[model samples]
Target: MDFNLGTCFYILANYKGYRMSVEECEIELRDYDGEFLRRDVKTEGSIQPEHEVRENCKGCKRKIKLMDEGCVFGCCRVCCSGITKKISSFIGGKVRCCDVHNDRIIKKPTKSVKKPIKKEYVKRICIYKSLSQIIYTGHGADELLAGYGRHRTAYLKGGYKEVTKVLKNEVGRLWERNLGRDDRCISSGGKEARFIFLEDGFVEFIQSLDVTFIADFELGQGVGDKRILRRYAEELGLKECGNLVKRAMQFGSRIGKVVGGEKGDEEFEKSEKFKPPTTDPTKYDKDYRFDITLPDWLPYLQTHGYCVISSAVSSQNTNLALKSLITSLKLLHGNDVDTWDIPEHGLISETLGQSSGAWLIRGSSIVKSAFERIWEEKDLIVSMDCVIIWLSWLNNSNFKPRSEGLHLDQNPFNKLDMISVQGMIPLIDVTEEIGGLQIIPGSHVGVLKEEFKDMHGDMRGKGDWCQAKEEYVEGRGGEARLVECKAGDLILWDSRTVHGGKVGSLGGRREGVEDGEIARASVTVAMVPRAWASEEVLEERKEGFRIGATFNHSPHETGTSTGTVKGKLYEDYIPIELTAEQRELL
Candidate 1:
């Protein structure tokens, strides 16, 4: 309390014949232990009456408690403290529900702002996304792969017959059992829910398995939850992951851990703000975005089934690839889109399809590294049937693609296992505004390969090459995003990924040229590991290089030659001074 000016003055005035100055008398009055000081120091009078302490809740203080613990310590069971009440009971306290509180913490539907797109160094984020985005839940895995403890129990008692019965029951009820809850949890993070294990191909693979191979008495006891999955994991060098037993997510993430089982009221008193249970890792916030770089390319490709690397090849090399195409087509100028006309018999189409060796000149260390990382080896072979230059906006007519939207490279004629990946390096920017290759994100894993495997036997001699399922096409209808990139950016995709050339609009036509204006140009080179190709194929490729002939463009098409092709010589067009790793690819 501040000293009153008038009181200080009066005390100074009372300081008569003593040699004390006015300031000194004021100081004495301030230090004096008089009635006011004694009143300020009195602790006895400050304590509230005992009756007042028993009147209200310790938290909100509106309700009355007649000596009952919950009524006094915890607030009225309504809006403010129910989360705390739920937490308390979860930890082992006998939660007595009133009209307002429930026995279990009810999941309240909460609305939030749209979550932003997450970008990260692909591998680092893959683990996080694997858990958080489209989870590969162990729901169906348990039944299909014999992953449950109970499955082991049933097997030990009744053998494979019992095991298959259990599996059939679980598999049949998969949609009813997990979809609703999983959707709720996954949607909380602003991600659409999808499960890899429940896809039809994986389900069929499990169903087709002989019970003996899946669960044998000789193979040693118990329902092997995820037995097949664990074996695959072990084969992939994830022995620890293979051995790790399954636990419910609620327990694994500590969401079900009780707070005050033996600690008593002191534990309850410690929680002040009522922190909610969360599964997201503390190391990174939900909104954190990762700046992608060169090192992230391979992991991104593997995880997402696609990635774009900017400046993967020099502009000169990219331009040379375009130049080779121009020379092969017998066009007047590389710069003039008007001159890039197709012949009446579609000779240009033939040239565009088989200009494979021409694109080998564009290969650089960066491109080679990306390929090596993809196939996981240096021994690689350029796809003989790619190198197409899409004059998407040509002749001022909106190009309508003949094939129905997105398609996979794997047709019915080829086995599902014979998949090839391709890379498209644009000489110009392929933007969404100006149409280009449209790819479905994550289709390589979720849809493509699985669909291929599912279509295997039925599609063989049907003569209908496109094996795309109706559900897949419809489900991912709006998800086919344009593979946008700048000049020299390389867009890579798995062969099985759902992708196709997007027909460009007349709006993409150049301002100056009212007719035949092409806005984008790209050079796509199909690549597979050299190890995958036979000696005959390699010999044919080498012979093509020696004789200056173009090989067949696609596996579906046969090879044809325009007698003595005119262009830059084969050696000049292809890389001559190659590194040992580069030579391995050639």
Candidate 2:
């Protein structure tokens, strides 16, 4: 951190907004200026330019006016006149939090927050211990209006295959398109900028108008796209900003892009580590016990049903317990919620024969009812277990379970944490969408339980789609963003974290009939006890924690996604190019 200005900023945050001193600024200015100055390296000696110092040092430059010897801070010697003043004023003033990122120009990385306090509303004085508030620019025109390629694309693509290919590519492009731009654009004003996009793939080779960009559900093929969002953006008050093709994210302050660029050659779907068909995902379970990944507190999800497993319990014991649980409530014991329960908790009782039964159990089988209920939703919510179970039971609707094993919470019935057994708590599985579970990073921190509206206090105060119903999430400024991951990669999120489905493909004939059913395939999981578990598992399972994210979660109005499956294996069907070594070994 080098500073490049004549006057440095001394941010003494007091109640009367932030305060600074003339002397302090004078002293710190040198350091600040040093941060912006470029230096020349020499063994014997060398003569560099004067004005040549303007450009930040790449190697060596003809001009070296700013500073010959580099300062402690890696300075860029950019000599824009008022640039320093703006930097000084920004650093010097008392800033209020905004729904945007404000650290774009600062040396520090600014985090996004729920909302921004306007200058008039800010307190004049703050305490000495207070830190400078960071801010971001609003989402700009995109915040209010949408600009997906409308009907125009339909005309460009010659046929179904061509259109389908573009559709697939669109979703993948999001990772690259939003990377640098979102963080940079919003934070410049010390405000936050964020948006959501769901697509069957990419769109925009279209460019429609009186038409929309994203398709709505009724449109089927056209609906899977984000045309609806563009329409929503316009209704909200955002304007179309020119041709609005996606802009590269690297243009702004997001450091991740500088550290890492898109590895287009690699396949994202593969990171999900989807398995091939006929493979008993459990067969590879040499160390862990469950079909899913293990947590640090407990390597194997060995069925202790009770908190403590007898030291003697073997892998067979855990397997038998899992099998028995499946026997009790075929879908529930599997730890996946099938369909919306309405008052939603009823299924818990239905599964464990717990009190939730009335709310969830439809008839002989909760699984059957779950599907029928999902058939009602215009929008689908999906997770991993939903995919697995849908496939497992696709051929056998008649195989209804008599009951689920006793809820470990009750004995003879006291078997498991009722929450864990029932899967009422949020458990994250990255496969729900190829992008991994979406989250509002740091949205969890800096919020008081009282101020928090939903499970997570929203930073943007924009939308609620991730948590509440369409009306609720949008009403509260709830936001979402996809976190990309590799297959087999285990991502641990807070139980309250909110996420939704990203549809890949759909089609299920009710009875080998042909195509009457539309299924949204995904995976799922449940949280269990073991205080030492959450923290321990993440460190042991993942290579490293790339970002420190405090998630936002809402318990009320929270609903789970529907599940569906295709006979096709995740590995064979995805457009992935495996490593050469993998092929040779195969």
Candidate 3:
């Protein structure tokens, strides 16, 4: 027996003491000239040429009738003769005709019938009953040879270091992931399943060899993975099998068609058990409304470069905002916060930043009032940005600050007079242990003064914003301050401030945290005076709103649309309606 499993090809060439037997079966076919034909022959042997086989048969005395060009009769002949032969031999079996019309043999066709087929299982059962008790399968070869797409992704991501790690993990967990299930299925036919690749001695020898010798990821796809095994197969004169592109067993055997196709997989995905519990928006008190009163923190904001206004947004509004965000997360990502690969500042759902629900707090009167008071202007446009849901406890074990460190959102070289005020409303209380914003106090003062002009150019033109050098910040005698605040508090900062998020540690759960027990959850809400935005920018913002696109924290700047509305997950979203004030922001 021979089998090609994904990247590896296996052959059991010679078993000295075993003798294979052939069985005779009746088969029906049609000649190339459309004549009905029937023959009884050994199923295992190849058929001789039609002319040669016809020469051995005696001519029949009964009048023979020709069949319709494309109709099949017997299932055995259709299955044994292969697809090409089955197509030519449409009508199968010996025909019993009482009447012939216009020199054509016509029989009423039977009703079309369909039945679920498990050919592999039936074939195995038949083999075990008549041939042998042991069956060879190419099962464990893929796990050992890095034959999956994930292996290629891992190799591309971190080279051999990541790929080898993935392989070792797969090999270690093979028993539960594959071997156990495969053994149960294969052994149900009362036959032993042999995995030569997974044999202890062979696996040990493979493990001892350099990973590069086993799999060369750089060669790309089929030729790259299972390098040594492919070489062995080629040396054994199995070039076609060795060079065959890797394909999953289900696909290669066409078993996926019988198992219900992609719809089945979609149903399975929709049936996930871990449904995130929804937050009750009705339970929270809605005492907040729009206000535009200037606070005493204005002078503090000027000197310190950032200010935290306590209770700037009402607790009820914050809860409602949190509910909306959590619901969106559940719909889009299953709310699987633990598995998210936290970006540079622990931002997730950034692509969904411009969703109408994200602005539940940002669009509220109280939040809008704060922004208007800061800018001292009644006409203010809100920045379409995302919420930050940081689950710091998950990454505390291996936390490391990004090498780029503190950066400025605004380019100092762009314009000294242009000031963009960025703000965030913490949906829950942020403590030092729970982690929040980390900023170098008063960095904006020197930045506005152009004192650090020689430090670096504004990198925004190059696709990234300017970042302050560590020595540059330290030289200014500025210290990084971790600003802690309560739920519904508004934290605002000048765009020139050197800032970044500090990853938090595990601590006692705080009150009013309804977002999956998240350590830190905040909505980035910024507002600039409406006078600053050009008509071109306003039109782009309108287009963004129409398509549910996300944007950065500068209302005056042109925003890039995230194109999330076109995604499958977005199909579950209930469209958001904007208030008059919210429309003004867009």
Query: All candidates' TM-scores?
Result: 0.41, 0.20, 0.44
Candidate 2 global CA lDDT score: 0.26
Clash totals for all candidate models: 15, 105, 9
Give the candidate number with the greatest lDDT: 3
The predicted structure with the larger TM-score, 2 or 3, is 3
* Model 2 lDDT tens row, 186-269: 343344333322221223333333223334211222222345554555677754632123333332222112213324344353
Question: For residues 213-249, could you state the per-residue lDDT of candidate 1 as single tens digits?
Answer: 7643222212134556667788999887765646554
**Candidate 1 or 3, higher lDDT?**
3
Ordered list by lDDT, greatest first: 3, 1, 2
The number of the candidate with the highest TM-score is 3
Residues 311-380, candidate 3: write the lDDT tens digits.
5655667788777776766656675754554554546543457554576776665566566667777788
RMSD, every candidate, angstroms = 28.9, 24.0, 24.3
Query: Which model is ahead, 1 or 2, in terms of lDDT?
Result: 1
